[model samples]
Target: MERDIGDLTIEIDRTLCIGSGSCVGLASETFEIDEQNLVRFQDETPDIDPERLKEACAVCPVDALRVYDGDEQIVP
Candidate 1:
């Protein structure tokens, strides 16, 4: 879906994240691997593509990636 929100928000369930790095690979500007090898947000306001974010969420090995718009609408 095409969205035009103020900004994008991404959430990762650390408990469910398997460190597969798919999200990081897809949206490196928004996602990254912490020292613990867990998925974490790279910055508070990182540049991200809505469609690529959705792709990252879709390819998450454990469904741990969630992307939301400024209106809190889930994108994938």
Candidate 2:
């Protein structure tokens, strides 16, 4: 799943996620761990800093989280 936040786009690959809370620890207001321990976006995500989002995505050990700027990927 993905969402456009300002000029950046954030995505979560549920299949690739390993139930790690790295992204949640960095951006709780933006990400959450579901009952199945998968990462998902908050229902009402606020305006998040692009760099913060990138940091959260980068912390994913399984590379399940991703951030993109237009057509270019900026995070793992």
Candidate 3:
């Protein structure tokens, strides 16, 4: 799944995700981990700082989360 939050573009690779709650735990407004432990979004525009947002994406254990700002990838 994909979502745009402020200037960041977040792409989640569901197949790669390990059901880690890191993203949701850091930015609840931007991400939610379901009962099945998959990630979902609260909204497109999350109320969070850019670096913090990137950190949320960075914390995903499987590298399932990708964050982009325009054409640049901010998170691995």
Judged by whole-model lDDT over C-alpha atoms, candidate 2 comes out at 0.91
TM match of model 2 to true structure: 0.96
Per-residue C-alpha lDDT of model 3 across residues 7-29, encoded as one tens digit per residue: 78989898888887889888887
- What local lDDT does model 1 show for residue 66? 66
Preferred candidate (lDDT higher): 2 or 3: 2
Residue-level lDDT tens digits of model 2 in 1-76: 9998889999889999998899999999999999998999999989888788889999999999888999999887
- Candidate 1 vs 2: which has more lDDT: 2
Pairs that collide, model 2: none
Where in model 1 is the C-alpha error above 4 Å? 1-8, 69-76
Error of 3 at 36 (Å): 2.2
Q: In terms of TM-score, how similar is model 1 to the real structure?
A: 0.72
The order by descending TM-score is 2, 3, 1
Higher-ranked by TM-score: 1 or 2: 2
TM-score of each: 0.72, 0.96, 0.86
Residue 31 miss distance in model 2 (angstroms) = 0.3
Regarding TM-score, does 2 or 3 come out ahead? 2
